[model samples]
Target: MPIRAVVFDFGGVLFDWNPDHLYRQLIPDAEERRRFLSEVCSPAWNLQQDAGRPIAEANAVLVAEHPQHAALIRAFYERWPETLAGLLPEGVALMERLEAAGMPLYGLTNWSAETFPYAWEHYPLLHRFRHIVVSGREKLIKPDPAIYRLLFQRMAQDLPALQPAELVFIDDSQKNADAASALGWHGIHHLDAQTTAARLHALGVDC
Candidate 1:
């Protein structure tokens, strides 16, 4: 089937977001910072918020478990804005090309609902997507087939004839991409903009 639409994953794909951006400044020592990120405000712990857990609740849970690192735990969400460095230029350019070509674009992201507003406000280009399915809003995260199904459901509202195979999903995580592929969508494990563009071209997508 011809690719009819493109679905983008937000964090590592479109936006350059990393807790390390904030942690490096907070804990200057490389080893200390690594430990803090790994043991304290960890990726797994932060994923709960991405899964729709309330920010306050997440912070409280971490704080309770590591009282000594309470301040650091609170800082995770308190300074969440710092984590979003900016948009990836090449990905933005590719999106722009697709938009210009009139290909329907959509966003499927695993981001905290509370922090998403900041990106929505800061990056006007995010408005380019016809619709965005935020995992936090739905209390689901990617790599879970349910979330991908939700995306198809929403897309179907506007494009009733759309089939899973007609969509192409680009994500930084191979696991997430594999999940989309399981449902028959063309999943691009986006490692870089150049590689992603090449893959899209191979799939007969213009951009």
Candidate 2:
């Protein structure tokens, strides 16, 4: 089906998304790694933090709630690092082309509330998307059907003609992309932005 809408996952699909890169470079000690990873990255604990809480609030709440890991929690926040690479030229070009072609564009990302804005400070071009959906802002993360549904609803609002097969979503994570597809939306697992953009352009999707 011809794609009337093109949605993208912001992190790895457009820019490099590597938490390990921060850990491996910043924290060389194995013991510190174990401590930080356990308390900070634990899904249950991180969920509260990811859902729009200020980092300080998250830190205090997490530390108080998980007393056993209090010491590690402090280090985790202090050590957390983020990076921003320039948008890939091909990806940027493709997005512009798609915009010019009048295809509705959207973004679905799993970034934490704090992180997304910080990332935005660096990658201002993110403002280009027609509708942007971030899990942190919605208090729901991807791989969960609700987040994808929200994107679908928003896209429908902008491109009233939108239908399942007419939308194309790209994400680096199979789990997330699969979730989008499970909702009957068309999705492509991204390998690399340049190649993926080229392929989409070839398909005449305008991206």
For this target, which candidate reaches the highest lDDT against the unseen true structure?
1
Error at 90, model 2, angstroms: 5.1
Off by over 4 Å in 1: none
**Model 1 TM-score relative to the real fold:** 0.98
Residue-wise C-alpha lDDT for candidate 1, range 1-207, written one tens digit per residue: 888899999888889999899988889999999999998888898899999999999988888999998888898889989998998999899899889988999999999999999999999988989999988999999999999999899899888788999999999999999999999999999999999999999889897
lDDT of 2 at 167: 74
Compared with the true structure, model 2 gives a TM-score of 0.76
C-alpha root-mean-square deviation, candidate 2: 3.5
lDDT for each residue of candidate 2 in 135-162, tens digit (9 for 90 to 100): 8889888788988888888878877777
**Pairs of residues at least 3 apart in sequence or in different chains that clash in candidate 1:** none
For this target, which candidate reaches the highest TM-score against the unseen true structure?
1
